[model samples]
Target: MRIAVTRPEEDAGPLKARLEALDHEVVMAPLMTITPRASVHIPDLPWQVIAVTSANGIRALPPGHGLTSIRTLTVGPQSLKAATAAGFRAEAQGGDVNGLSAFIRAELTPAAGPILYLSGAETSGDLEGQLGAAGFACHRAVLYDAVPAAGLGPVDALLRRGEIDAVLLYSPRSARIWRQLTEAAGLSAQAGKLRNFCLSTNVASVLPEHWTRLVAESPDEQAMLALLAQKGRSL
Candidate 1:
């Protein structure tokens, strides 16, 4: 199966390697480029815990500022791995914002001090607002920004030829960008023919209604890859 990956190149490396390992032809067609925000300065506050929604957030942080000592809560396995690799004490909060919020509420109290939420410029959930309303002080620091791709790149040609078998959507923003690019390139019909393996329902919701969409049971990369493998076996 020929799979189209629409995640940023940096984040797509693992997925591409995993797909190839499964004996599938993988196409690198990133719909967004992640750029780290410049002039980032960690506030001199007594932050009790750090919240990371994406791996990019961890990547954007500069090393060696007594950061590794902080307890970190990550959105999923990927972010947990990244935070751990960066020497921070990290724990996975699954892949859902609501689940993370619940975990925070259950594990810590408002008196535990403020949480530093290292996030991208554009986020799916209002983590700060949600945590704040829950009586926890959550300070969000925009560490990176996802810039949309200018064109569809090679995926456009493959999509038009109907050579692609599946499309992997990691985020709702990427799915929305793919929709825009496909419609703009007049390849919506071709795109609709391929199977869409979304990381979550949120990602699936942004894709074309006519497309054969498969949402992962869990909102994580492993689940998405499992969906691909299952689809491959069926094919």
Candidate 2:
């Protein structure tokens, strides 16, 4: 089966490699590109814990893995690797920011230590709200910015030719941007032709309204791959 891996480039490596290991032909088409924040600024002092939701945030950290001693809480497995590589002592990893918050609140609670959140410029989940309400002094550091994948001549051509089977969306931003690209490429309003499998319902809901079938995977990438493999077998 031919599967198109559609996360941002920095985040697509593990999933694409895993799919290939499973013997599925994978296409690594990133729907977004992550670049470090040109206006670079990370706090001078370290925090008790650091939160990482995207691998981009990990890769974009300023020179010298500043988060060496900080206990890093990550959102997913792929981010875990990036976080560890960036020198954070990953204490725990969750499926998403919501889950990561839950874990952090449970594990590190009622403490006066500063909690720093490493994220993109635009964040979907309210990590600060959740963590703040739980009594953690959460500070957010925007390490990267996510940009849309424009000039999609190949993806557009593939959809028009009906050669693409499905699209895997890792975030709501990706879903929204890809929907626009698809419509701009004249691929929208074609329901039931290309399946949409998203990381969760929130991601799926952002998809174009014309697509009637959108499958939601569990919050984790392993679960997403499992569900994808299941669908592959069913096909």
Candidate 3:
């Protein structure tokens, strides 16, 4: 099976490895690109916890933060790995920001400490504001932004050849861009020729009107990958 990974490029390597590990060929057709936002500030703060949603955010962590200084929560395993590599240890993880918010409301808010969020400049989740409204003061550190990737060279050829077996989508931005890329790349005529549409929940909801949406039970790659494997590229 040939899988088209539509995550932004920096994140594409691991998904490609996962597909290859599963014995599928991965076409790295990253529909979106992650561009670090210039002039984004990383606050030097004594905080409650650092919440991270994407590895890109973790990768964008600033210079002065130490691993043991604060508790950390990540939205997914990939971000956790990146956080670890960035020298931030996650004291709690697993839930998306919603669950993390619930956890904070239950546990951290009572501690009455400040929190810092390491996040993309144009992020999907707003854990800080939500937590703030719910009575927690969280400082945020904006790190990166995602824009459409450039030059879909072989993607055109692959679509023309009808070679894509699965379309793997991670974010709504990517999903919308996938539709745009397909149309701009002139692959709309090949609709339904795709064997499956594997996407995380938010991404699935935003897919073009024409694409079949296979929902992952959760937003993590493991969930999407599990859905992709179990659904057997026939969605």
Candidate 4:
């Protein structure tokens, strides 16, 4: 099975390796480039906890920011691992923004001080707005930006030759970008023949209506990989 990986290069490494180990041919078609913001300033506020929505957020932190001392709340296991590896004490993990907001609201109170949210320039969820509505003070700092790829990489040729079998979509933005690139390359018909494995329903919804899509039971990389492996077995 030949699978197209459309995640950013840095985030695609582990998944690509894992897919290859499962005996699947992997194509690297990074849909975005993650650029860390230069000169990120940690505000001098009374921050009781830190919130991280993506692993890229943790990677954007400058060394010795003294944020490691604070308890961090991560959106998923990957972010939690990245946070712990960065020397921060990760207190909890949420499946998504809503889960994270609920966790924070249930565990902490308005007296717990403000939360500093580390995020990218384009955020899919409104973590700050959600927390603020719950009487929690949340400050967001854009630490990185995911710039969309100008064109599809090897995917254009692969689809044209009908070599691609499946595609992995991690986010809605990437899914939309993949669709746009495929259309631009005049390979939309070829792409429609391939199966799309999405990390979540939101990711799948962005794709074209006629394309075959599979949504993972859980909104995480591990679950998506498992679904791919299962589909690989059936093929």
Candidate 5:
């Protein structure tokens, strides 16, 4: 199977290696570019906890910020791993923003100071809004920005040649970007011919109804890879 990976290059490395290990041809087609916000400042406050929905948020932290002493909470396995590797005491909830919010509500209270949320410029879920509505003070710091790619690179040729069998879509935004770019490149029909393996239903929902789509059992990379492996065997 020739699979196109649409995640940013930093996040796509492990997925690419995994797909290649499964004997699939992997095409690096990053639909978005991740840029760390250099001018952003971390607020000086008695933060009770740190929250991050994406690993990119953790990576975007300025060098020597010295926030590792604060307890960190992550949205899923990947973010948790990143936080842990960064020398912080971190824990992960179920693979979604709602679950992370629920975990915070259950574990902490408004009396426990504020939560510093490290995040990207645009997010699919409103973590701070959700927590704020629940009487929790959630301070969000935009640490990075994910800019959409204007065109597909190598994947364009593959789609045109009808050589791509599947596309790995990690987020709704990236999925939408892929759809828009392919449509603009006059390769919508070719792209629709391939199966799309999405990390979750939200990601899959962005695709056209006529295209074949497979969603992971859970909204994490491990589950996504498992779904791909299972489907690849049957194909």
Candidate 6:
């Protein structure tokens, strides 16, 4: 199967490798571009933990911020991997913002210190609000921004040629971008023909209603990959 991966370029390599390992031809069609915010600073405070909702947050950390000793809590496996690679003492939640907030509530307390949240300019949900409502001090720093792509010409061409078998959508924003771009390119009908594998129901919700959408049981890449493998076997 030829799979189109629509995650941002910075995060697409691993997913592409995973798809290739499963013996599928991969098409890199990033729907969003990650831009690091200029002059962003990691708050120099006695933080209880460094919380990240995406790997881009960790990647956006400025060099020599002197915060590596702080324990990092990531929203998922990929963010955890990024935190670990950045030489921080890191742990990961099950996945998603709610789980991460719950994990922090369960494991840590506000009395310890404030949580330093490194995040993108646009977030799907209010992680800070959830923790703040629980009497926790959240110092949020907008480290990056995920900007939608202008077009998806490569993917449009592939869809028109009937060469793509599926599309892997990781976020609702990216899925929305794909839907809008495909419509703009006049490939909406062709795009509907391919299987659409989404990381979560929220991600799938924004896609065209008539499109064949398969959502992962869990909102993670592993689960999304499992859906692909299971569906591939069935096909």
Per-residue lDDT for 1-235 in model 2, tens only? Answer: 6666778766777777887888877767787788887767777664887888877878888886556786777887777887777677875466888888888888786574888888888887999889999888888988787887775646666666677777787788877887787777666854236767778888888875567445645687777777777777766
Candidates 2 and 5, the one with greater lDDT: 5
Model 4 bad stretches (over 4 Å): none
Which pairs clash inside model 3?
Answer: none
Error of 5 at 68 (Å): 0.3
Over 1-235, each residue of candidate 3 has an lDDT whose tens digit, in order, gives 7877777778888778878999888877877667776666555556767777788886755455464456678777788888777666675464577777777777766355777777776666678788889887787777777777665657778888877777877777777777777777778767446644544567666765566678888767778778878877453
Pairwise lDDT winner, candidates 1 and 6:
6
Model 3, residue 102: distance off in Å is: 2.0
Task: Give Cα-based local distance difference scores for all models.
Answer: 0.87, 0.76, 0.71, 0.88, 0.90, 0.88
lDDT of 5 by residue, 10-42 (tens): 788877888788788888999999999887889
**lDDT digits (tens) for residues 15-50 of candidate 1:** 788889888899999998989988888887899899
**How displaced is residue 62 in candidate 6, in Å?**
1.2
Assess candidate 6 and give its lDDT.
Answer: 0.88
Across 82-126, the per-residue lDDT of candidate 4 in tens digits comes to 888888899556788778988889988978799999999987779
* Regions of candidate 6 where Cα sits further than 4 Å from its true position: none
The better candidate by TM-score, 2 or 4, is 4
Candidate 4: residue pairs that collide: none
Worst 10 residues of 1 by lDDT: 61-70
RMSD of each: 1.2, 2.0, 2.3, 1.3, 1.2, 1.2
Off by over 4 Å in 1: none
At residue 20, give the lDDT of candidate 6.
87
Can you list the residue pairs that collide in candidate 5? Answer: none
